[model samples]
Target: MSIVETVTADMKTAMKARDKQTLSVIRMLKAALMNEKVKVNHELTDEEAQAVIAREYKQRKESLDEFQKGNREDLVTETQAELKVVEKYMPKQLSQAEIEKIVATTIAEVGATGTSDFGKVMGAVMPKVKGKADGKLVNQAVKSQLS
Candidate 1:
């Protein structure tokens, strides 16, 4: 099934199982997806849905970091749980090694010789790596390769 359909089915399952936390996160995801559809005046494709899931996952990660920094273990645990739920809908993340390999190839393809070509290399690589890897990791990999 498509990601959207799977999410809808899971929402029903969460309700049936009386999983409140799971249900809340699923509803939040559905809301985000629906908002995107309304904004674009069309339903989201699988890739677009993946993008939404990735965005949600990123937000949760940020929240988790902030909670940890503030020594709020309770909130950190909560955000981590939410992050796990959000990640279930995203594409399998690429490993750092895999990301590095792709970045290396992209740098060569773009003739990126130094940090000055970072933007050029990133533009060529981001589309290929989007949703497969996190942007910060990809940027670091590109910088290391170019520098």
Candidate 2:
């Protein structure tokens, strides 16, 4: 099923089960997906729908970091819960080791020898790991490999 349909189905289930948290997250996701659809003026491919979900997941992660830094336990707990709901649709993330390996291989392929080659290495690396790894972690791995 397409993500839009899946979200709609899950929304129904969440409502029937009285799962307020899941319902809320699903509704938010539906809205985000719909907005993207309207913005682009076309039906979203599954990839586009997944991208919207990933963006939501990424936003929550950033918020989680801020909440932790601020020592706001209440908001931290809630954000983490929201992250869990969002994560249900995310592609399985690559491990650090896997990202490093990809960086190493790409660095060699691009002949990126120093930090000066940061953009070169990144340009080559991002696509190989797209949707599979976190961009921050990929950046760290590439920097370490190049420098």
Candidate 3:
């Protein structure tokens, strides 16, 4: 099923189950997806839908970090819950070791010898890693490999 349909079905289920937190997250996702569709004036491919979900997940992670630093346990707990709900829609994340291996290979493939080649390495690596790895993790792996 398409992500929109899957989310719609899950939204109904959440409503029936009285899962308010999940319902709220699903609603936000649906809105984001719909807005993207309207913005682009076309139906979203599965990949586009995944991108939208990934963006939402990234936003949640940033919020989680801020809440943690601010020592807001209540907000941190709530953001963590929302993050879990958003993550259900993302592709499986790559482990750090797995990401490092890919970055190492790509660095060699691109002949990236130093930080000056960071863009070259990242350009080659990002498409390969894409939805499977977080960009921040991939960046760290690339920096470690180069420096």
The list of candidate 1 runs beyond 4 A from truth reads none
Clashes of each: 0, 0, 0
In the order shown, the candidates' Cα RMSDs to the true structure are 0.8, 0.9, 0.8
Would you estimate the TM-scores of all the predictions?
A: 0.97, 0.96, 0.97
Top-scoring candidate (lDDT) = 3
User: Which 10-residue window in model 2 sums to the lowest lDDT?
Assistant: 138-147
The better-scoring model by lDDT among 2 and 3 is: 3
Write the residue-wise lDDT of candidate 3 on 37-94 in tens digits: 9999999999999999999999999999999999999999999999999888999999
Residue pairs clashing, model 3: none
Q: Model 1, range 95-145, lDDT digits (tens) per residue? A: 999999999988888888899999999999999988989999998998888
Candidate 3, which segments miss by more than 4 Å at Cα?
none
| TM-score, model 3 to reference | 0.97
